[model samples]
Target: MGNLSRKKKKNKKEKQKEKTKNNLIDLQMDQENEKIQKTIKIITLGTGESGKSTFLKQLSILYSTGFEESSRELYASTIQKNLIHYIKILLRAAHSLGIKMQEENIRLSRSFFAFDDLTTQSLQAIIQLWSDPGLKEAYERRSEFQLPDMSKYFLDDAERIGKSDYLPTDQDILNCRIPTTGVNELNIVVDDLPWVVVDVGGQRSERRKWIHHFDGVTLVVYVVALSEYDQRLFEDQTVNRMLESLDLFAKTINNECFENKNCVVLFNKDDIFRKKIKEIPLKTCFPNFTGENDYQSTCKFIQEKFDKIGRNKKRVIFYHFTCATDTESMRAVFDVVSSTILQNQLNVGGYL
Candidate 1:
C-alpha cells in the first residue's frame, strides 16, 4: 500500500511539471507574437509629382539621419539642372504666349540653353531674365503648361543657388524634385516600433512594379496634390491631373488586396493649394462639386470624393491635409498616423 501511494504522488508531481513546461512555451510564443505585432509596414502610392518622395524624405529627417554630404552634392547638381530646365520652359512658354523679350535677353537665353553645364555667367543671365516682365507674365499662366510647383520658390532663391559653393539646405532638399524609379525601402524605428516604408515610382510606366510590394503592406498612404486641380498630366496632357489622381486612388483604395488593410489619404501641397484655390475654382476639375471655393469647403469636397469610394471597404481609413515640405506640419500629422496604427493593432487583438 505504501509503495502504491508513493507512486501516485510521484505521478501527480510529474504531471504538474509537464503542465508548467507547456505554459512556459506558450508564454514565450505570446511574447514573440507581441514583438511581431509591433512592426509596421507602410507603402506610399500616388501619381507622378504627388509628393510621395518628399514624404519619404520627411520620414528620414524625422526618424533617421539626414542626407550625407555626397547625397547633398548630387541634389545640388540636380537643383542646378532643374533651375536651367525651369527657365528654359519659361522662355519657351513666353515665346508661345507672344510675350517678347529684349533682344539682348533673347540672345542670352539662346546662349544659356546651349551651354552643356551651369556656370556663373549663365546664372547671371538667369537672374536678369527672371526679372523680365514678359517671363513673369508667362509664369502667372503656368497652369496652362507643366511645371513643378516649386518653381517659384527655387527661382526666387536664384542668387543664393547660383553661388559656386551653394549647398542645398534641408528645406531645399525636401523641395527638390527627383522621380523615384523602381523601389526604395526605408527601415525606421518610431515609438519603439520597427517600421518598413516602401516608396515606388508614381509614374504610369513604373506602376507595374507596385503589385509586388502590395503583398505584405500594413498601410497604404495614398497621396494627392490638391494643386493638381489646375494642371495636366505630363505623360498625357489631354487628361487633367487631379482627375487622374482620383481615378488612381479609387482603384488603389478599393483594390481586393487592400480590403483588409488600413489606408490614409493625404491631400498634400496644402500651401500651394491654399493659394491656387483663391485663383482657380475647385469646380474646374470637380465640376460636380457645389461647395464654396474657400479653403475649408473645397478641401472637404475633395475629401468626400475619396471617402465615398472607400465607404464599402472592410478596413479603416484616415485623412489629413499635408504640406510634405513643411517638417513641423508633417511632425504633427505623422503623430496622428502612428496613433491610428497602434489603435488598429489593439482593436485586432481585442484589447480595445
Candidate 2:
C-alpha cells in the first residue's frame, strides 16, 4: 500500500513537469509568431534588367536555403528560351543590316523568325541554324548593330542548351534575362527579422500593376543601370534608357502613395559602367555636364541628377553604388540597408 502511494505521487510530479515544459514551448512559439507578424515588406523597383532578380537571388543564396529543385529547373527552361531569343535577335539584326546569308541559312533564319509559336521541331531548327558557319559569321559581325548587352552570353550557350541534359548554374541563372511579368515575393529572415522582398516588372506595361503593392510598403529599393546611359530601351527604341530611368525615379518618389516611404537608390552595374565610362564620356549622355571622364566624377554627376528629383520631397533618400552580381558587395550593401530600415522603424515608432 505504501509503495502504491509513492508511485501515485511520482506520477503526479512527472505530469506537472510535462505540463510546465509544454507551457514553455507554447510561450516560445507565441513570441516567434509575434516576431513574424512584425515583418518588414520591401519592394524592389527598377527598370528591366537593372538587377532586381539578381539581387533577390543573392539574398536567397546568402540567407535562405537557395532555390528548390523545381525553381532551378524553371531557370533552366528560361536559359533555353533565352537561347532562342538570342538567335532571333541576331537574325533580325542581320536582316536589318542587309547582311546577305547563304541560301540554306537564309531559308532557316526566315522560317524561324516568322514563326509565332515555337515547337520541338522549331527548337531543333534553331539549333541547326545556330550551328551553321554562316550564322556564326553574322554573330561575329553583331557589333555593327545594337545588340543587347546580354546577347553574347546567351549566344555562347546556345549549343549547350540544345543538349538533352542541360542544367543552369547559379552564375548562368543570374546572368539569364527573363523579364518579370508580375509581382514576385520572397520571404527571408534577416537578423532575426522577417523580411518580405517584392520584385515587380519594370517595363512600361508592368508599371500599372505597381499601385496595388504600395499600400503597406516599408522601403523601396530603386535600381538603375549606370551603363545604360548610351543605350535605348528594347521595347521602345526611341526612348533613351538612362533618361527613362530618371523619369521613372522622379515619378516613383513623387507619387503620393509613397510619400512617407524611405527609398534606397542603387546605381547598379557599376562594373560595366567603370569600363564603359573610360571609352564613352558622360558628356555624350548629358551634354551640359563637364566632369572628368573618371569613375568618381561621373557617378557623382549621376547621383546629383537623381538627388535633384528628391530635393523638394520630405522623405529620406539613401544612395548606394552597387554591382548586384557581386555577392560580397551586395552583402555589405544589404547590411547597411538592414540597419537603415531598423533605425527608421524605431524612429517612426513602428514599422514603416
Candidate 3:
C-alpha cells in the first residue's frame, strides 16, 4: 500500500508540470495574437515636398529612439545630392526664363552635366556658382519659376555640404528635401499600438503607385503644403500646386476602398505661410476666398477649401495646421490623432 501511494504522488506532480507548461504556451500565443490584432496601418499621401516623409521622420524621432548613426551619415550624401538637384532646377529655370548665365557659370553648369556622379571637387564648383552675381539674380527670380521652398536652404548650405567631412545635423536632415521615388514604410509603436506608416512619392508620376496601398490602410494622413497656395508644380508649371493637392484629397476620400477609413488633412508649413500670408493674398490662387490676411482667417479659409472636397463622403476628416519640423507641436498633434483613431476603432468594434 505504501508503494502505490508514492507512485500516485509522482504522477500527480508530473501532471501539474505539464498543465503549467501548456498554460505558458497558451499565454504566449495569446500575446502574439494580440499584437497582430493591434497592428494599425497608416499611409501618408501628398504632393511632392508636401511633408509626408517629414511627418514619418517626426514619428521616428519622437516615438523611436531616433535615427541611427548610419542613417545620419546617409543624409550627408543626400545633402550633396540635393545641392546638385537644386542647381539643376536653377539651370532649368534660367533656361526657361531666357536668363543668360555668365560664361563661367555656364561652364560650371556644363561640368555638372558632364559628371554622372558628384565628386567633392565638382560640388565645390557648384558652390562657386552660388556666388556668381548672375546666378544669384536668376535665383532671385526663382519665384517666377516653380522651384522648391527648400531651394534657398540647400543653396545656403552648399559650401558646408561640399566639405569632405561634413555631417548633417538632425535639423539639417529634417529640412533636407528628397523626392520619394517609391513607397517607404516605417514600423513604429505609438501609444502601445504597433503602427506601420507608409510614405509614397508625391509627384504626378508617383500617384499611379498609390492605389496599390489603399486596400489595407487604417488611416490616410494627407499632407498639403499651406504655403503651396502661391506655388506651381515643378513638373507642370501651368497647374497650381495647391489645386492639385485639393483634387488628390478629393479622389482619395471618395474612393470606395477607403470609404470607411479616417483621414487627417495636415495643412503643413504654417510657419512659411505665416511669413508669406500678408504679402501673398489667399485670393491669388483661390479667388473665391474672402478671408482676412491674418493667419487664423486664412487657415480657416484654406481648411474650408479642403473640407468642401469631402463634404459628401461618410469618412471623418480632421484638419490641423502643422509645421512638420516642429517636434513638440507634431508630438501633441500625433497624440490627439492616435487617440481619435483608437476611439473610432473601438466604436467600430462596439466597445465604445
Candidate 4:
C-alpha cells in the first residue's frame, strides 16, 4: 500500500505538472490565433554551427514521416558529409595558426571535424584549416615556419606566419543566413508567425548577416550544447560571442515592430549531463541558469532574461531536447519543432 501510494502520489504530481504545461500551451495558442488565419513564417535563424541544420533536417524528416531508414541514411552519409567537410577545413586553418599537418594527426583530426553538427562543433568550434595531405606543415609555400626536428615537433604546431592560403585577418563580420526547406510535416496554420531563422556564424564578421534575413521571425531557438559547457567551462568567449551576436541582432530589429517576437532558448542535450544534475539545474549551471524540464525551464529562463533586460520576456518560451539524427537517440528533430509550434502557438496575433 505504501509503495503504491508513493508511486500514485508521484504520478499525480507529474500529471498536475503536465496539466499546467498544457494550460500554458493552450493559452499561448489562443493568443496566437486571435487574428484568425494568421500566416506565421518560421525563419530558422541560427549560426552555422548552432544545429540549425540538424533541426531543419529533423523537421524535414518529421514532415516527411514514414521515410525508409535506408533513404535517410544515404542522405546523411552523402550530402551531409560533404557539406560538413567544407565547413571544417575553413576553421582548422585559422586555429592551427599555421601548424603543418602531421600525416597521422591529419586523418584523426579530420575525423573530429567530419561529423559536423551543433553539438560536436559547439564543443570544439573548428578553429583552424588543414594543410595539404602529403606535404608537411614545414613544407614551403613562401616558407617562413620551418622546424628543425620534424620528428620532435608536431607538424600542426609549426608557426603559420607566412602561409599562402590565408583567409585573411580582415574578414568582415556578417552572420550567414542559410535558407532551407523540407518542412512538409507541420500545417500552414501551425506555422502562422513568420519565421526568419538567423544562423549566426561564429566568426565575428559572419554575425552581421543574421539581421538581413529576419523578415518576420517570431521566435529564437538558442542551441547550447552540454558538451560545450564541459569543454569551455563557460570560460571561453565562444558562448558570449554567440550571446553578443544575438544581442546585436536584436538591436538591428525595430523593437516596436518585432516586439511580440518570441525567443525559445533551447538547451539541446540533457543526455550529456547525467553527472551534473546535482550541481545546478542544467539550464542554470551557467550564469543565468533556469530551472529543469525542457519546456518550462526554457520559458522561465527566456522570461527571466527578458525581464532582466526590461524586454517583454513573457512572450518568450523555452524547451530542451536531446535530439540526434541517429536511430538510438530515440528523438526526432521535427518532433521538437512540432511541439514548439503547438505549445507556443507562435502564429498567434500581435497581442492577445
Task: Indicate which candidate wins on TM-score.
Answer: 1
Candidate 1 per-residue C-alpha lDDT over 53-109 given as tens digits, one digit per residue, 9 for 90 to 100: 999999999999989999999999999878888899999999888998888888888
Task: Give candidate 1's error at residue 159 in angstroms.
Answer: 1.5
lDDT of each: 0.88, 0.79, 0.82, 0.41
Report residue 333 deviation for candidate 4 (angstroms): 8.2
Rank by TM-score (best first): 1, 3, 2, 4
Q: Please provide, for model 4 over 298-342, each residue's C-alpha lDDT reduced to its tens digit, 9 standing for 90 to 100.
A: 445544543454246445544454533232342443455556653
- Clashing pairs in model 3, backbone N/Cα/C closer than 3 A: none
Query: For model 3, how does the per-residue alpha-carbon lDDT over 128-170 read when each residue is reduced to its tens digit?
Result: 8777676677776665776667767778877777778878877
Error of 4 at 128 (Å): 24
Give the Cα-based TM-score of candidate 3 against the true structure: 0.80
**Rank order (by lDDT, best first):** 1, 3, 2, 4
TM-score of 2: 0.76
Evaluated at residue 318, the lDDT of candidate 1 is: 88
Error of 3 at 20 (Å): 16
